[model samples]
Target chain A: MIEALQFEFMRNAVFAGLLASILCGIIGSFVVVNRLIFLAGGIAHAAYGGIGIAFFFGIPYIYGTIGVSLAAAFIMTAVTIKAKNRQDTFIGVLWAVGMAMGVILIDLTPGYHVDLMSYLFGSILAVPSADIRWMAGLGAVTLVLTILFYRDILAISYDAEFARLRGVPVNLLYFIYIALVAVSIVFIIRVVGLILVIALMTIPPYIAEKYVRSLMMMMVLSVLLSVVFNMTGLWVSYHMDLTSGATIIMVAATGFFISLGVDQVISFSRKRKTQRSSRKMLKTKKDAL
Target chain B: MTQVSPVIQVQDVSFSYNREPTLTNLTFEVPEREFLAIIGPNGGGKSTLIKLILGLLEPNHGRILVKGRSPRKMSKIFGYVPQDVNVNIQFPIAVMDVILMGRLRHRGHFGINKQDRQRVMELMTMTGIPGLENRKIRDLSAGQRERVFIARALAADPDILILDEPTASVDTAGKTELYALLKDLNETKTIIVVSHDLMIVSSYVKSVACVNQGIHYHPKNEITETMLQMGYHCPVELIAHGQPHRILKTHGDF
Candidate 1:
C-alpha cells in the first residue's frame, strides 16, 4: 500500500484527487448555499453533450465540453434569473433535455467505440499527467477568481436583491457564478464522472457547513474533508479492486453520517451537563434554606 | 431644520407585468431624512412602486431618480429590505457573514478585510444584536432575523433605506421595537417603508404615501377618510378608540 505512491498512475490519481477535492470543496460551498445542487447536477450531466459533440466533431473533449457546458450554464442562469418564480421547472426541463441530447448524439458518432463506463463511473486509475495539468490550471484560476469576488459572491448567494441595492452588478455576478460552476463541473466530471459528480461536489461541503462560522472557513474545512475522503477512497479502491467513483462517494457518505452523529452526541452531552448543574444548584439552595 | 435634497424622485411612472398594469401614472418624492410610509391593500402596487424606485423593475413611462441620479447610476446609495426574509435557513451562513455581505460594493470583488469585520460589528451593535454575530442565521427568531437584515442594510451606511413590510412577520412587541429603531434611524437617513398596518405607520412615520395605482402624499397627522378612499379605492373608517368603527360612504368618481 505504501509503495503505491511510487507508481506514475497512482501519483497522478492522488494529485488529481487532491486538486479536484479543493476545487469541488470551494465551488460546492457556493453550490450548496445557493441551492444550486440540482443546477450543478444538470450542468455536469449536460457536459456529456460536449463529450458527444467532441466525438462527432473530432475535437478535444475538454474544449468541446467546456464550451458547451458554459453555454448551457449561461442559458440556465439567464432563464432562472429572468423568470425567478418559475426557475425549478425550467431547470428540470433543461436537465432532461441535455441528458437526452447527449445520449442521442453519442449514439450518432460514427464508428465510436469509447467505453461509456469510464465517463460515467470515472477512471481515476487511468488519470494521465495531461489531465492533471488541466485540473491544476483550472483549479488555480478558480481559486484566484473566488478570492477576488468573495464579497460579491457572498452577497449574492445570501441575498441577491440586497446585493443589487449595494450597487454590486448582480446579473454579471450571477452569470460569472454559473460559468465558474460550469468549469468546476467539467473538471469534477473528470474525477467522479457525471453520474456521481453531484455527491462529490455537495457532500463534503454539506458536512463541513455544520462546524464552520464563515463561508471561507467552510470552504477550507470542506476542501480538507474532500481531500481526505478522495484520497482514502482512492486507496481503498486500489486495495479492494473496486470502482474509484463509488468508493469516493461511500467515503463522503460515511463522513456525513459521522458528522451528524458527532453533532447529536455533543448536543446530548451539553443538555445532560446543564441538567446536572441545575440539580446541584437546587440541592445547594435547599440546604441553605 | 435644514432640508436636504430629495433622495428619491418619481414622476409619472407606470409599470405592468404581462401587459397587465400594476402601477399607473404614479408620482412621488421622498425628501432626504424623511420617514415615509407607503400603505395600501394587497395587489395595490405598493411593492411594485417600491421595486420601481429600487430599480428592480423598469417603468414603462416617466422617470425615477435616486440621489439626484437615475436608479441605475445611484444603486450604491440605496439599501433595501424586502418583505419576505424566508431564506433557506439550512444554508450555511453566519450572522456576521450575512452582514458583511452588505459591504460588497465597498469591498468589490476581494474578500472582506479587518475594517469590514469592524463595520459589521458596529452595525450589529447599532441594531442591538451584537450577540448574534457568531450565531448561525437559521437559529435566529423572526425578529432577530429582521434585525440581522437591518444590520446588513445599515452596514452600507447608505443615504436611503427601503423596507417592504419589515414588521409583518414579527410579534407585536417586535413590531413596536422595530418601528422605534426605524424612527431613530430616520433622524439621519431617508426611510421608505411599505406596510399594511396603518396604526403603526400613523404613530411612527412623518409622512405617508398611499398608493393603489397612483400615489397620494399626506402629512402623517392629516390623513383622512377621503384620502384613504381615494388611494385605496375602498371605503375607510377611522375608528376612534375602537368603539365600533363606522364605514364612510365611497366618494363619486372624478
Candidate 2:
C-alpha cells in the first residue's frame, strides 16, 4: 500500500486530495452551519456552464469555472439577501437554469466528443501536477481567509443581524463568504462531480461538528476526515475499478452513519452513569435520615 | 440627566411593504442615555420602524438619523439585540464563539486579537454568563440564548442599544433580570426596547412610546386606559398592582 504512493499520478492524486480536503473542511463548516448546502450545489452545477464556456472559448477550465461560478454565487447571494423569504424558490430556479444552460452549451460544441461522465463523476487518478498546483493555491487562500475572518464568519453564521449591529460589515463578509464557496466549488468539481460536490463539502463537517468544541476545531477534524475518506475511496477505486467520486461519497456516507452511531452510544452511557449516581445519592440520604 | 445629542432620531419617515403603508410621516427622537420602550399592537409597524432605524430596511419616504447621522452612515455606532436569538440555535456554534463575533468589525476580516478576546470576556462578565463560553448555543435555555446575543451586541461597546421584544419568550424571572440589566446599561448608554408587555415596561423604562400608525411619547408613569386603547386598538383597564398587575381588555380593532 505504501509503494502505491511512488507513481507520479498517485503522488499527484494524494496531493490533490489533501488540498481539496483542506478547502472542503474550512469552507464546508460554513456551508453546513449557514444552511447553504443547496446554494453551494446551485453554484457547483452552475459551474458546468463555465466548462462549456471554456470549451467554446478555448480558455483554461479553472479560470472559466472560477469566473462563471463567482458570477452565479454573486447572483445567488444577492437574490437571497434581497428577498430572503423567497430564497428556496429562487435558488431552485437558478439551479435548473444553470444546469440546463450547461447541457445545452455542451451539446452545441461541434465535433467534440468529450467524455462527459468523467467530468460529471470525477477521475481523481487522472489528476495531473498542474491540477494539484491549482488545488494547493486555492486551499492556501481559503485557509488564510478563513483564519483571518474567523470571528466575523462565526457571528454571521449564527446570527447575522446581531453581527451587523456590532459594526461588523455583514454584507461585505457575506459576499466574501460566497466568493470563497465559489472558489472551493471550482476545485471541488474536479474531485467530485457537481452533483455530489455538496455531499463532499458537507458530510465531513457534519460529522466533525459532533466532537469538536469550536469552529476552528471542527474545520481541522473535517479536513482529517475528508482526507481519510478520499484516500480510502481512491484505494478502493484502484483495486475494484470503481468510479472515484462515487466511491468517495459512499465512503463518506458510511463514516457519517458510524459517527452518528458512536455519538448515540456515548450519550446513552453518559445518561446511564448520571442516573446511577443520582439513585445512589438518594439512597444515602434515606439511610442518613 | 446630562444632556447630549439624541442617540436616535426619526423624522417624517414613511415605509410601505409591497405598496401597503406600514408607517406614515412618523417622527420621534430617543434622547441619549434614556431607556425608551415602544409598545404597539401586532402589524402596527413597530418592528418596521425599528428596522428602518437599524438600516435593515429602506424607508419609502423621509429620513432616519442615528447619533446625528443617517442610518447608513451610523451603522457602526449602534448595537442591537433582536427579539429571539434562538432563530438558528441548533446551528453548531458555541456561546463564547458567538460573543466573540461582536468584535469582528473592530478586528476586521482576520481573527480576533487579544483586545477582542478581552472585550468578549468583559461582555460575558457584564451579562453574568462568564462560565458559559464553551457551551453550545443550542444547549442553552431561551434566556441564556438571549444573554449570548446581548453579549455579542455589547462587544462593540456602542453608545446605544436597541432590542426588539427581548422579554417576549422569556419567563418572569428572565424578564426581570433582563430589565435590571437594561436599567444598569441605561446609566451611560441609551437603551431602546420594543415590547407588548406594557406593565413590565412601564415599571422599568424611563419613558414609553405608544406607537400604532404613529407614535405618542409619555414620561415614566402608569400606562393609562386611553394610551392602551390607542396603542393596542382596544379598551384596556389596569387591574391590581403591587403583587400582580394585569391589563383587562377585549379585542376592539386588533
Candidate 3:
C-alpha cells in the first residue's frame, strides 16, 4: 500500500477517501439521528438526473448535480413535513424517476462516449486532482457550518418545535441542513458513487451511536470508523484488483455485523449475571426466613 | 399609577389550520409567577393556545404579547417543554447533552462555560436526577426521562416555562413528582401547562383555562359545571380535585 501511494492516482484516491470519510461522519451523524437516510438516499439517486443534464447540456457536473439534488431535497423536505405519512412513497417515486431520467438523458447524448457505469459503481482509482479539490472545498464548508451551528442543529434534531419556540430559526436551519445533505451527496458520489453512498453514511454512524454518549463523540468516532473501513477496503481491493466502492461497503457491513454480535453478547452476559445474583438473593432470603 | 404588566397577554386571538378554525376569539392573560393550567378535549385547541403563546404559531385575527412585547421578540424569556412526539428513542445522546441543548439559543460570549455546567448540575439535582448526567437518555425509564426533559426546560433560565402534557407518558407516582416539581418552580417562574391530567394538575395550578373554539378562564383552582360543558361540548362529570380517579358525579348505571 505504501509503495502504491507513490503513484499520483493512488495518492488522490487516499485524499478523496479521507475527505469523504470526514464529511460522511459529520453529516451522517445528523442524518442518522434525524432519520433522514431515506430522504438523503433519494437526494443522492436524484442527483443522477443532474449528472445527465450536465453531460447533455455540456455544463459542469458539479453545478447540475448539486442543483437537481437540492431541488429534490427541498421537495422531499416539504412533503415530509406536510404529508408525513406518505413521505416514504414520495421519496421512492423521486428516487426511481431520478435514475430513469439520468439513464434516458445519458442515452440521448450524442457523439461524446462516456463510461456511465463509473457513476453508479464509482471509479475511486480514477479520482482526478480537480475532484479532490472539490471534495476538500465541500468538506471545509461542511465542517465550518457544522461547527457554527452545532448546538442549533442538535436542538432542532432533538425537538424542532421546542427549538422554534426558543427562537433557534428551526425552518432556516432545517432547510439549510437538508441543502447541505444534497451537496454532500455530490461529495460521496465522487468516491463511493450515488448507488453506494447511504451505506458509507449510515453504517459507521449507526455503530458509533451505540458506543458514544453524545452527538459530538458520535461524529468523531464515526469518522474514525469510516476512515478505517476506507483504508482497509482500499488496501484489500488494491491487492485483489476489485471495485473499491463495493469493497468499502463490504468492510463497513462487516464492521456492522461485528458490532451487533458484540452488543448481543454483552447483553446476554449481563442478563445471566443478573439472574445469578437474583437467585443467590432469593436463596439468602429463604434461609433467613 | 404604577401597574404590573401581565407576563403573557392574548387579546382576541384566533387561529386555524387550512381554513378550519381551531381557536377563535380567545382572550386571556397570565400574570407574573402564576401557575396556570389549560384543559380541553383532544383537538380543542389547548396545544394551539400554548403554541400561540410560545410564538410557534401566529393568531389569524388578534394578537399575542409577552411582557408587552411580541412573543417572537421576547422569545428568549420563554422556555418550552413540548410533547416530544418525534423524539427518537434510539438517538445517541447523553442526559447532559440533551439539557445543554436548551442553552443553544442563549447568546453566551464564550459559549458553554463553567457557569452553564454548574447551572445544569443544579437543575439536575433540583429535578431529582443528579449523578445521571453521563447516562444515555435511552437508558432512562419513562419517569426518569420526564425528569430529564424538565431539567432541560429549566436550563434556559427563562422567566416563563411552558409545557404541553408533560406527564402523559409518566406513571402515577412520576406524575405527582412532576407536578410537585412544577409547583416548586412556580415560586420564581411563571408556568403555563397545557394538560389533560386535570385531577392531578388542578391542585397545583392557581387558575384554569378551558379551551374549545373559544376560551373560558377562571382565575382560581375550582372547575365549575358550566366550564366543563363548554370545554367538553357535552355533559361531563368533574372528578373532584385533589382526589384523582374519584368520580365526583357518575351516571345511575353504577
Can you write out model 2's per-residue Cα lDDT over B1-254, one digit (the tens) per residue?
Answer: 56767778888988888777888888877887888877777788778888898888888889888877778767666778877676976677778777777666563445567788877888888786888888988888887788888887788777788888777667877778778888888888888888777555547778777777777776553454566667655212243664333233234522
Compute each candidate's TM-score over C-alphas. 0.90, 0.91, 0.92
DockQ metric for all predictions = 0.59, 0.56, 0.66
**In model 3, where do residues sit more than 4 Å from their true spots?**
A81-86, B1-4, B107-110, B169-177, B198-202, B233-254
Query: Against the true structure, whose lDDT is highest?
Result: 3
Q: Candidate 1's residue-wise lDDT over A1-289, tens digit each?
A: 5799899988989998999998888989989888898889878877877887888888988898898889888888888877878877777777777778777878888787567898898888888888899889978987997888787777788777777877777788778778888988887787888888899988988888888767888899999999999999998999999999889989989998999999999999999999999999999999999
What is the TM-score ranking, best to worst? 3, 2, 1
Predicted structure 2: lDDT? 0.80
B136-165, model 1: which lDDT tens digit per residue? 888888888888888887877777898888
True contacts kept of each: 0.74, 0.67, 0.81
When summed lDDT is taken over every stretch of 10 residues in candidate 2 chain B, the lowest stretch is: B242-251
lDDT of 3 by residue, A25-117 (tens): 999999999999999999999999998898889998888898999999999999998888999999999999988888888889997856767
Query: How many clashes (backbone atoms < 3 Å, residues ≥3 apart in a chain or on different chains) does model 3 have?
Result: 0
lDDT of 2 by residue, A14-81 (tens): 78788889989989988988889989988988888788888777787788789989999999899898
Better of 1 and 2 by DockQ: 1
